[model samples]
Target: MGDQSDKGQHPANSPTPYAPYAPYRRPGRRPYSVRMTTGGSGIAHGFPHLDTVRAALAALFRRLSHDTVSTFPTSVLPVDVAFDDTEDVHLGAQRIARAVVHQLHLPDARIVITFREMEHAATVELTAGPEYFVELNDRFRRHRKDIGAALAHEVTHVWLHRLDLSFPGTRDNEILTDTAAAYLGAGWLLLDAYREHGPFSQKLGYLTPEEFGYVLAKRADFFDEDPAPWFTSPQAYDAYTAGRARARQDARRPPLAGAGWAARLRYAKDRRAAQDPRRTAGPVAGPGDGYAFEPAAGTGAPLRVSFPCPTCWQRIRVPVRGHLQARCGLCKTLLDCDT
Candidate 1:
């Protein structure tokens, strides 16, 4: 059922986070200190592809594994007090989450924490009003490490709910939520919370442990912060390693383009990249079989040719011209071009 706790309210005293508010912000919503610049090669770091995200995670975990031998590094936020059976860590997590939301200057947002016997570890009761509530499973009282992650997930719902953002469907919405939690921050906690040892294990988040690693790695790369010191769970580390392998496998095999699933995949890619100003919105084409029509230097409709890369086979489009080299941004492969 529900985990009962005496500390249901926000902690009276909590240390302020370092750099509580900084330059980074969500795309198109404002507070982005600078726009990411993209070259003609369409290479930039703002809005990233799935494969791009995967590669970043692989690189991060490799570094983390090398740095840790016996104990976790001391740099991560501490939550040992929450681990006590008598203490409720939810209040502390709530304070931390509120600080994050405050950075965005979001208004009057209130989150009421409650416990229930729900199918999910936690669920948010989103509403149109300024105050919303979340229910957590009772098991979290014993699994203190998961408090931050659980609150992060519910807080993510609160953030997204306020924005009223549109998605293709519920699954896509959940994906975006997971991506936001990792990208905006709080991802490291989610990854650290993942545990699978003998009969005791807990994972509380929308994304799979692997997916969490991918986004967390990407965020870590953006901020230049090393999270290896913060990871305390061996099983969480294992999940990241496994995710890295999967990312590599996925990178080797690019999706085939056709009028069927290929077209649908392209649509999804566009949706993913739409909010990213660093990405260029090219004409929607059918894989590599057709040309993306572009307006000519003159008034006439100019012809643009697109083709697949020789290495990873990802489609690349450039205006129809003569001999030049086109770089595949996804895989960084050079293609001999005649478009």
Candidate 2:
């Protein structure tokens, strides 16, 4: 997103995102970034839902606060969600649902789990409730193993509902729920549920496999936890690897001080252009990696650099003066930038 939009588009005091931060909403909106592929054959492979996912992360930090977010340092363990084939189906389902609710820190959220033939993996009734009703696809009764994944998603909907944190449309709200689950711990089940083989595929939630991996990787990096060894699906593991590369790339973007030599070289040239008194007096578009330079605010004010925080994806605007440290208002991650 080589953003060249005017800064005025984003009102300084406005809560809603506009201009550079609203990537998914910028292009006259997109038709539900990914569809629910219960059959799993059409499982999206990459990061189309990235913008909403990033926004969701920011929202979690904004709503829950950094201290509250830090409370979930551990991902849900595999044993907690296990379902034995010989066990009573209803007992197993309830057990897994309780585990997911506990992991989400929703002790008061009673999620009653049931099964039915549904086009989607699961659905949750999001009303004012200490008790929420959830319906899992009947397929999980036989498949058994994936009951954990479906419950995790539906339970998270209840969690988001209670917090009153959501996006406008159904598609974006679903993406938020998935991102919240993964980032708060318990979303790795959604990623691990994804499996693709000849004539067989299955994925849960609105996010693509890679998006889930990306969120999970973000959580893992912050908590110093590794989830790769827990993946049972080869395809899910591959998506996680690809997603990790994308997450790592965020820290390597220009102006962050850790940017690669090539990126630093390019950013330096863009910085030069912005500083040139004779240069065209407007915003200069950088590469697609979400960094750009704007002209000085006044005659002598320094030109500013705007970029996304690798942790929460919130846009940060800093002056052109070199070698400064900045802290993101959201997520509270400190950065050493040679701006």
Candidate 3:
């Protein structure tokens, strides 16, 4: 997120969350800086809500120091914090970078934060900056809760980068990082906001409210806690309802058949499908191919057997003799081979 204006800024103090630290400074590296703006008005129009969010986050952080000792395992160190009244993207980027370097003790990693002037029509956007760095926009900084959340979110990314832990080729990696932050307790404040306001409702281009809630739920499950109280969004409520139903269904189902079943079925189906030229051309292959053979020809080549989705009752096809890990395209229900 990028800053909205360039006035009424304040200098950071020692105890301030934005204070820079000695460990964060690097020789020949540009320092990170922050700028705050003023002269905006209206409760729904500008920075007031953002300020409220920021104060809440600060209070939440202070409370966490006392209430969540077990949740956050990192050593709390002094950090140098500051804000600016300029839109110089380079300076804003440096400010975030300095904060991370000073706060965390990761020596081998190089961190950079960047801001860009995006079209006003766009919401807040974040991306991996140059050379193993993370970037946030000024509009993001304008919203205090979003700033805290974005910082925590990006910091988690840096932590994961340093640890060489990442999911392969999916946005799910970012979601995992968000979950990591909530699990670690730094970003649960953001999660709380998300639960309240719903994600992206503030025009921040991050996770949707349901997506945030889903990850929060996953984090709670990982830590064995009840997530209901922390949630605040109507979107979160709906997701929780759906998630609870799925959990109940999972509880009633038998254990998955295992890798042996997957391997056996995959090999069997592939082998049969490869050998039968007719199988390539139409729906039914043959009676002995382990598929429920139907002579109907217009339903397209039956690569799998059709079953009702447990959640929605939509007709879904599962490979008759292949790995049975398919999920419903409609209701997202995962299926086992036994129908």
Best lDDT goes to which candidate? 2
On TM-score, the stronger of 1 and 2 is 2
Q: TM per model? A: 0.53, 0.85, 0.39
* Each model's Cα RMSD: 14.6, 13.9, 14.4
lDDT of 1 at 282: 55
> Which digits, one per residue and each the tens of the lDDT, describe model 1 over residues 221-299?
4455555666788866766665545434332222222224555456346433432346455544434333343334454
Q: Per-residue lDDT of 31-90 in model 3, one digit per residue for the tens?
A: 222112222221122111222222222332333332442444442221322234354333
In candidate 2 the C-alpha lDDT for residue 100 amounts to 85
Best by TM-score: 2
Q: Give model 1's TM-score versus the native structure.
A: 0.53
> Model 1 clash pairs?
2-138, 3-138, 320-339, 321-339
Ranking by TM-score: 2, 1, 3
List ranges where model 3 is wrong by over 4 Å: 1-116, 119-135, 170-172, 186-208, 237-241, 244-248, 256-339
